[model samples]
Target: MKWQNALKDYQLYLKIERGLSENSIENYSRDVKKLMVYLESHNIDEAPTTITTEIIQGFIYSISKSVNARSQSRIISGLRSFFSYLVFEDYMTSNPLELIESPKIGRKLPDTLSENEINDIINAIDLSKPEGERNRAILETLYGCGLRVSELINLKISDLFFNEGFIRVTGKGDKQRFVPIIDVTQKYINIYRNEIRNHLNIQAGFEDTLFLNRRGKQLTRAMIFTIIKQLAEKIGLKKNISPHTFRHSFATHLLENKADLRSIQLMLGHESITTTEIYVHLDKSHLTNVVEEFHPRRQSLKK
Candidate 1:
């Protein structure tokens, strides 16, 4: 089959069967498209099913020179999944990447901000501007609720449940969950909604969108990153940070305070407990405290 047709089918499968988000689907499709470009540029007339391991290896080798090991590993994984899907659908007899292995790479821990740093970043906001209250609310929601950038942008007015103290979040794969919201976060959101958002000339179809651009359209993910970057710069934060930094801080702080992994996992909407375990590594003291507080031999060890 042609590479284009195969890619189209793979995207459909990702959406309909796997229920992947549009961003994820785009990333997966891009991996396959890269291989197609490689083949076409080299004048190698190989179809999706006919492409050999040697050709695939050449494509990978070419990319490894430019990308870091982590990014290269992700591309390899994406290609493996694509071929595996083909095999599942009888498009191929076996997966070419079945024998290939990803490069050895250490687990990269996420960067987190301390409470002081977070407070400093929030305090740097210019409240004199019209978007000032809105910006403060955005940061608060991002850190307070442990939301992904996509989730924060897509949040709707109807999703707020202040009386119940929960804000419904639509996480990756379109899965929905209700996360608890603190009174402080609610107050900031109310200020934005009443003072800033309500006064904007909201365009059609964006009336329900909780966060908006100056044009009354929904905020983009890039805009969220820019806002955080500017705040970090204003506060002289030397560390590189993005919208996801707040999420990492939220998870890490919860672990340090002795919150259970499963609860944090659910709040972050992670599908696996293993993903949440990264926070345990962020603070080894938490593990030590767990053993000190709960272990049966702790009383004897005190002696």
Candidate 2:
């Protein structure tokens, strides 16, 4: 079997069997292609099933000059997944990357905004402006639903099942989940739709799109960032915030308010509970209170 055909089949497997998003599939394919190029340059030709660990190590060494440990780590993981799929399909008897060690990199926490800071930023919006209502709704939805900016921008009007207190979110890999929407957020979205969105002449193929620019086109990722940046600037906040700040704030606030970790994991669409553990850093007072009030070992013998 040709290497090219194997790569093609692998791409399909990632999309259909593994159920990765388009962006994720592209990244994995790029990583494998890089390996293929490296082997070609060294006058070594091998199909997917014939690849060796030494060649993989050589490829890592070649890229080490220009890539950082974190990025190299990601590429190594991608290649490992590709080869593992080959073994799963019986194309190979052993995994080439099984013994490969990924470089150690400490977990980097994402930037978060305090609830008060988020409120101050949203309060700074110029409500009299044409985009004010839209911005208000955008900010509310971002925090209320803990949505990724991509999911927020591509959000559809029909996807808002507000009457049922839920919105259908299309997350990574096109996985769909029902996220609860509070009445307050529902009110803001309704106001924006009736009072602001109702006036715009929406573009074709975007009539169902929840948010639109002045030109009636769908909002781009950059536009979403720009909106958040402007709000942060207006409030004189300096935390290097982004559209994702709202998401972080949502999770942080929920944890602070005593929400369950498992529920937060599901709401955030995280693949693992470990990913949701970062929010634990956002609040420790609850734990302190619990320990002070309920720990029997610490209770006084007189009591």
Candidate 3:
């Protein structure tokens, strides 16, 4: 079969059978596309079913000069998944990537902002501007709700159940979860809604969207990053941060304050507890406190 045809089928399967989001499907497709491009540029004419492990290895070797280990590992993983899908469908007898091993990359810890830094970034916003209130609300929602950039951008006014103190978030794979909202976050949102968003001549389709651009449409992910970047610069903060930093800070702070990992995982919409455990690495003191407080031998040792 043609590589393009196989890729098209794979994307459909990812969407329909696996129930992955569009963004995820695109990322997965990108890896296969890279291999296809490599084949074309090298004048190698081979279908997906006929491709050998050596060709794939050559592609990996060619990319190693340009990409870091982490990215190379991801590409390898993506391609492996695609080939595994082919094997599962009986298009191939064996996977070409089955013997390939991903590079050993260190676990990169996420950067987190302290409470002071978070406040400083928010405070740097000029409240005099028309979008200031909206920006503030956006930051508040991002940090308070521990939302992913996609989740924040897609948030709707109807998703807010203020009376119940919960905001519904649709996370990866279209999975929905209810995250608790603090009163402070709710207050800022209300300010933005009543003061700024209400005045926008919202486009027809974006009527329910919580955050809007000047064109009265939903905000883009890049727009949110730009807002945070400007704020960080205004405050003279040096650490490189993005929209995800707030999420990491949110989970880290909660863990520092003695919140359980399971609860943080639920709020952060992590698929596995292992994903949430990364935050524990940020605060060794919290673990010490846990041991001191809960360990049965602690009381005996104190006596």
Candidate 4:
């Protein structure tokens, strides 16, 4: 089969069968496109079905020189998924990537902001500007809800269930979950809504969108990044941080405070408890505390 046809079919399967989000589908497709580009540039005439492991290996080797190990591993994983799809469809008898292994890499821990640092960043916002209240609310929501930047921007006014003490979040793959919203977070959001958002001449389609730009349209992902970056610079924060850092901080803080991993996993909308386990590595002291507080042997010794 033609490379283009195979990729097109794979994209459809990812969307319909795997239920991947558009962003995820794009990332997966890009990996295949990179291989296609490599093939064309090298004048290698090979169909998707006929492409050998050696050619794929050569492409990976060439890419390793230009990209980091993490990126290289992701590309390999993406290609492996694509080939596995082909095998499932009977396009190939065996997967070419079955024998290939992703590069061994260390588990890079996420960066987290201390409670004081987070407060400093929020405090640094200039309340004089028209968007200042909105910005503060945005930061509060980010740290408070531990939302992905995409989820935060796409949040709608109707999603707020304050009386019920929850906000419905649509996470990756359009999966919805209700996350508990604290009173402080609700107060800041209410301030922005009443004082700032209420005054904007909101565009027709974005009427329900929670966060809007000065033009009264939905905020872009880059806008969120820019906002946080400027805030970090203003506060003289030494560590590099992004919107995701707030999420990491939320999980790490919860773990440090003796919050159960399973609950954090549910709140974070992680599919696996393994994903939430990374926070355990962030604070070994929390684990020690758990043993000291609940271990029968420790309790007996204390008695």
Candidate 5:
């Protein structure tokens, strides 16, 4: 098979067979495509079924000079998945990636906004323009639904279930879940949709998309990032923040307000509770209060 065709099939396998979301499939595809681009540019023709580990290793080594360790690591992971898919389909007898090692890296915690800071950031947006209303709604959904940037970009108008007070979110792996929506968030979204989005000449394929660009096409991921970045600048908050700050703030604020970790995990669409446990760390006051209230002898004495 041609390398391009093999890459496409591998992507489909990852999606349909492995049940990965579009965003994840894109990342995996991007990693594999880097190798394709490298091979093409160098006039080195090798089919996916015949490529060896040495070629991959050398390509990685050549690219390492220009890219950061984190990006390089992600590319390696993507390549490994591609080879594993080949093994799964019996096209390859063994996985060449089994012996390759990923660079070890420490987990970095993302920055989160305080509830007040989030409120202030929203207040900073000038809602006079048509895009302003949409921007406000975007921030609401990002914080309220705790959606990833990709999920936000692809969110469908049909996904809103306001009558049920829930929104159907398509998360990583194209996994769908019904997350409860706050009334305040729904109100802003409807305002933008009815007042602004209703008048726009929407594109054919993206008719059901929630957020849109001026051309009435679906908003790009970079545009969303740019929106958030500009809002951060206006508010004059100096911490390094991204669209993910809203998601982290959503989880952190919930945990601080005594929301259950399991519930937060379900809302965030985390497959493992361990991933959600990062937000479960209690503040000193809560820890002290728990100690004072739950101590058996102290409770008996107080009564």
Candidate 6:
């Protein structure tokens, strides 16, 4: 089969069968495309079904010089999934990547902002500008709710249940969860809606979108990054940060302040408790507190 045809079929499988979001489908497809590019540049004529482990290994070796181990591992994983799909469909007898192993790498901790730094970043916004209120609300919601950038951008006005103190979030794989919203965040959103968003000449189909560009269309992920970058620069923050940093900080701060992991996992819309456990590594003090507060040995000693 042609490489492009296989890729198109794989994309459909990811979307229809796996129920992956467009962003995830694009990432998986891009990995396959990279391998296709390498094959073309080297004049290596091979089809997906005919490609050998040796050729794939060579492709990995070639990319090793350009990308870090973590990235190479992800590409390997993506390709592995693609071939596994083919094998499942009876196009191949065995998966070529079955014997390959990912590179051993340390678990990189996420960057987090302290309450002071977060306050400073928010305070740096130029409230005199028309977009200032909107920007402030955007930052507040991001930090307050621990939202992913995609979730924040696609947030809908209809999703807000302020009286119920929860906002509905659509997370990875189109899964939905209700996350509690604080009164302060609600106030800021109300300001933005009443003062700014309500005035926009909203484009068709964007009327329910909570955040909008000046053009009254939904905000892009890049725009969210740019906003955070400028805020960090304005406040002279030395640590590199993006929209996800707020999410990390939210989870870390909650853990430090004695919030339960199960509660945090639900709020963050993490399908697995393991995914939420990364925040546990961010605060050594929380670990100490846990031992002191609940460890049977420690409790007996106190008694």
> Which candidate model has the greater TM-score, 5 or 6?
6
> Could you say which candidate leads in TM-score?
4
Question: Per-prediction TM-score, please?
Answer: 0.98, 0.89, 0.98, 0.98, 0.82, 0.97
In terms of lDDT, model 1 sits at 0.94
What lDDT score belongs to each candidate, Candidate 1 first? 0.94, 0.88, 0.96, 0.95, 0.87, 0.95
Cα lDDT tens digits for candidate 2, 136-182:
99999999999998899889998999879999999998888889999
Task: Please provide, for model 4 over 1-303, each residue's C-alpha lDDT reduced to its tens digit, 9 standing for 90 to 100.
Answer: 999999999999999999898899999999999999999999999999988899989999999999999999999999999999999999998888888889999999999999999999999999999899999999999999989998999999999999999999999988999999999999999999999999999999999999999999999999999999999999899999999999999999999888999999999999999999999999999988998899999999987
Candidate 1: stretches off by over 4 Å: 300-303
Clashing pairs in 3: none
The digit string of per-residue lDDT tens for model 6 on 1-303 reads: 999899999999999999899999999999999999999999999999998899899999999999999999999999999999999989999999998888888888999999999999999999999899999999999999999999999999999999999999999989999999999999999999999999999999999999999999999999999999999999899999999999999999999999999999999999899999999989888989998999999999877
Error of 5 at 48 (Å): 3.7
Q: After aligning candidate 1 to the native by TM-score, how far in Å is the CA of 31 from where it should be?
A: 0.8
Model 6 lDDT on a 0 to 1 scale: 0.95
lDDT digits (tens) for residues 138-257 of candidate 1? 999999999999999999999999999999999988899999999999999999999999999999999999999989999999999999999999989999999999999999999999
Error of 3 at 16 (Å): 1.1
* TM-score, model 2 to reference: 0.89
Error of 2 at 38 (Å): 2.8
lDDT of 3 by residue, 1-303 (tens): 998899999999999999899999999999999999999999999999988999999999999999999999999999999999999999999999999999999999999999999999999999999899999999999999999999999999999999999999999988999999999999999999999999999999999999999889999999999999999999899999999999999999999999999999999999999999999989989999999998989978988
Which pairs clash in model 5? 21-173
- How are the candidates ranked when ordered by lDDT, highest leading? 3, 6, 4, 1, 2, 5
Cα deviation at 269, candidate 6, in Å, is 1.5
